[model samples]
Target: MDQPTRPSKTIACLSALIKIGSSQAYALFDSGSNTDSMTPEYANAIRGPRIKLTEQVTLQLGCIGS
Candidate 1:
């Protein structure tokens, strides 16, 4: 059987960049070694850690502060 591919950290990093409107490249460090998943600006906006407890998919929506 083929092994499932884990979600790419690059994907998340790019997402954060797009969301933040930044042109620079970003990297997503592992959650195990990283304290947070968002950019510096986004880190402050998070109320708390967001955990996905199931296989259910969902969308995260938020506005970037200008």
Candidate 2:
């Protein structure tokens, strides 16, 4: 079963390109989104500490023009 959809609304968001360690990345800001995502290359480039989570998460994104 699919989750109930929320009302789609257009809102202003802030996005910026910032340097993470040596590499740079585009950071997205979405107040309505339930989850955040990043590429493995970016994470590796940062070389931050890794912590194992007790639970895993699933990220679902709707395709354009469904």
Q: Using Cα atoms with residue i matched to residue i, what is each candidate's TM-score against the true structure?
A: 0.18, 0.56
**Shift in Å, residue 57, candidate 2:** 0.6
In model 2, which runs have C-alpha deviations exceeding 4 angstroms? 1-13, 18-24
Q: All candidates' lDDT scores? A: 0.47, 0.75
Clashes of each: 0, 0
Q: Please estimate how well model 2 matches the true structure, expressed as its whole-model Cα lDDT.
A: 0.75
For each of the candidates, the C-alpha root-mean-square deviation to the true structure, in angstroms, is: 14.6, 7.2
Worst lDDT run of 10 residues, candidate 2, spans 4-13
Best by TM-score: 2
In candidate 2, what are the lDDT values of residues 1-66, reduced to their tens digit? 876776667444689997766777889887789776677776777895566879997777778766
Q: Candidate 1 lDDT, tens digit per residue, 1-66?
A: 876788777345322333334334355444444233455465445443556657864545445752
